[model samples]
Target: MRRSSDLSPEIAEEAAWWRDAVFYQVYVRSFADSNGDGVGDLEGIRSRLGYLELLGVDALWLTPFYRSPMADHGYDVADPRDVDPLFGDLAAFDRLVADAHEHNIRVTVDLVPNHSSDLHEWFQEALHAGPGSMERARYVFREGRGFDGSQPPNNWTSVFGGPAWTRVPDGQWYLHLFAPEQPDLNWEHPEVRADLEQTLRFWLDRGVDGFRIDVAHGMAKPEGLPDMDIRPQAPGVLSDDVHDPRFDNDGVHEIHRMIRKVLDGYPGTMAVGEIWVKDDERFAAYVRPDELHLGFNFRLVQAGFDADAVRSAIEHSLAAVAPTGTPATWTLSNHDVVRHVTRYGGGAPGEQRARAMTLVELALPGVIYLYNGEELGLPNVELPDWALQDPTWERSGHTERGRDGCRVPIPWEGTSPPFGFSTAVNTWLPQPNEWDHLTAEAQLEDPGSMLSLYREALEHRKSNAGFAGEELEWYGAPAGCFAFRRKGGGLICALNTSGASVPLPPGKVLLSSGPMDGDQLPPDTAVWLV
Candidate 1:
């Protein structure tokens, strides 16, 4: 860790705790079960703090544990202040925060500000109040009957599928960018913004170090409600309005400015926005210093293993944010997306390829998020058709298997029932039978395991202060290789993405992806030369 006094004047100004932080994202449903209720809870996560500390992550990003109706997982929060009963209430959350701090790990919970569950008391009241009521103004409500009472206000499509607008039985239409159950909030309302600010204060006062804002770009919508041109990709599948300017309008900047103002009152509290945009330039706008502290890099997740693709993404990201004073954050996988192991490694050579891919992500120029099972080199579990619980499966006509496979419980103990996650009658998601061989306990004992490699890579990253906040200069390399220098404090990292010995660029080898023996790197490895 770089001490405050050790930081150079330029780096010191940008030296926030998250600059070099390694964040571990935990999907609460699959992490661990404390009461054996077949579901992971706050206490379950608390129990695993030592293991997380051992892995050397700077912080833990817990997916929604707040009160919800389980629509879109927990993103449709019904009550922001209270913890869900299934996740063990407010007291258990307090304990989890305290325990993590004891282990020198920071805690950041998911904050879904864009919408609220239909079952929420406020939404329920809005439903009864009809249009023109003060409570109804809290959400977006169109004053009119639907087209033939069947179509929505506009032709916009929901992210999950179908129309973005839904009509209440009372003859009013409302907008929902994602799922119908999650009604979008009206950010234009002063009360709504004030209420959200209070919610932030409530958690900050409770000792949360920061938050990972969910679907942040969807907070604002175009006021004109223009019709989106239809371009049906699949039969009955529309892709036109999907990128409609009205959907993710420029008004989001105002919303971000308001959020940053709230964050200003609480120092050292970080907010990372989940901006899902294809254009790097537009995505970088969300990360300006006055806006969000970090904007998620979905490019890395979608890059796969193509050397040229990876290079373009890194270079584009750096250029996109150069005008803004915000730093970049990279991730290979997350709860909503397909697992990196399965996405990048789909065939017989998947394992070796995944090993090389990890090195590529770690050597990037920003904070990196490591998914739970990635360090263990776990592949996506193939769940039976009947076992899948993800709403995406049903929503997408089963075209995609949905995220249930990746969301399965994390195996902690080898040869244990439910993989030691729960002792209840059954877990929400069943653990794979192969978990016996893939458990953390099994891999921790093996030095050649992916888990051990992750430890070494992380330690190497921390030891090199130059790599933390220094600017990256990309160097041209072979077709399957990438080299970058973090040229300060005398540190340079050159990574080889291929499975063969490549010529070294001259410095002592600091870390390697594969086996290391007396300064020699194994094939298909990455080496940090210092």
Candidate 2:
């Protein structure tokens, strides 16, 4: 096994660093805390560079840490160019970028282009400037419906629940696909496009490696703010339903093309979009040559733990990017969604399946993103209702528990709450006491731990030539089992999703998600044979 720094000079010379890369998604607030303020910050991330390097990741895809009022954590950006005081100043970010590069790790920050915080200077000015003013033109402000302008401008509801259009004091209604504090921008407005382009250049000029565009499919709306034919079954979840007129509109391609033009000016810097369009044809459009370098297709994330479901997800995801020749991004968990550990089942079974899926995911030929705390076999924290902070909790009228479960602070080195996440006893989101056994500190010493499994797998993926290539050949296997061979690599990854044990193919066992019975793979387990 080889470290990321030991990659062959030739392999590292590829112009696109993100292709076939393993990126670690750092949800800034939950990653680490150097300030003892019970919140993670840029300094904390900088201090943990060595840990990430040891884990063998090629890059860091950090979620937003920009200046905001915490309306939706950092997703609602008040200032794109400035760092939030809670995270650190611009100097701190510079230091983080400098140190991260020293570890041979690339840094990609989140870009929330779909909307801006209502507290943003521009949005505030728009509010005071009144409707139809140039200042108001930056956002999607419109007139209301009904005789007396009493109803919302449109029938579209927010992903976070309630009406998508919020009525302002001056009688005009503004579109906010998310929370009311986050007003959707008018992409058709030249000023809005210019401002976002400037924001991209600002971060790129600051030495940030790239950006992960938030709501990439959502910048542009149809000619008319038309009402969708469907309603979201669940509030705040990115709907995969194609009838969602509010997202993945044809106009969004132009916005992406403009963003791509800005990115093209800065060579080697990539732009990845968080696209939720289920249609492969539409999803592929965002990653067209003149658009994003990669688009996040969530088929795998939404799949069940069954073998057929996983296979279908992977097949669809691969087909989505086959035409473009770009790397297909694979992710099992992120800041949103239930952690894979919990999603698979819960205790032993869940951890086993999570580990199995990790092998399956990493084995695929593409860029893999591992969410923070995932390598530690961390499950979602079931927080008390009083501890919930996700905007959806209130927006959904408390009917939906929201995403706070997966955003808990990571357990670094200790055996109790906060672990080594912070010196302060109280973290922004409370850590579960049962996480003592799963801390990085504890796992590092256990050979059978998920941390060790990930370290070994990543190192192997980096060092071994067998993990190369984009083609996967399916091998005939028993029912509920999936066995696929790497096109040129002689590497076979097999998963037994059945009730009974399955016989292994002829090869040396390189890695197994769990203890195996000689050459037999038990149910809910995966193995890499070479």
* Per-candidate local distance difference test: 0.77, 0.89
For candidate 1, list the clashing residue pairs, or say none. Answer: none
**Residues 1-530, candidate 2, lDDT per residue (tens digit)?**
12235456565455488898899999999999999999999999999999999999999999999999998999999999999999999999999999999999999999999999999999999999997899999999888889989898778988887788889899999999999999998888998888888898888888887899999988888887777775446332577556788888888888888888887666667889999888998888888899999989888888879999999999999999999998899999998889988988988899989999999998999899999999999998889999999989899899888899999999998779889999999999999888889899999878999999999999999998889778999988898989998888878999888899999987999999998989799999999999
Candidate 2 — which pairs collide?
159-236
**What is candidate 1's local distance difference test score?**
0.77
* TM-score, model 1 to reference: 0.91
Q: Tell me, by TM-score, which candidate is best.
A: 2
In terms of lDDT, the best-performing candidate is 2
RMSD of each: 4.2, 3.5
lDDT by residue (tens digit), candidate 1, 395-464: 6677756677778888888596587788775788777676687788988878878788788777767776
Evaluated at residue 143, the lDDT of candidate 1 is 55
Off by over 4 Å in 1: 1-15, 143-149, 229-243, 465-469, 489-491, 495-501, 515-524
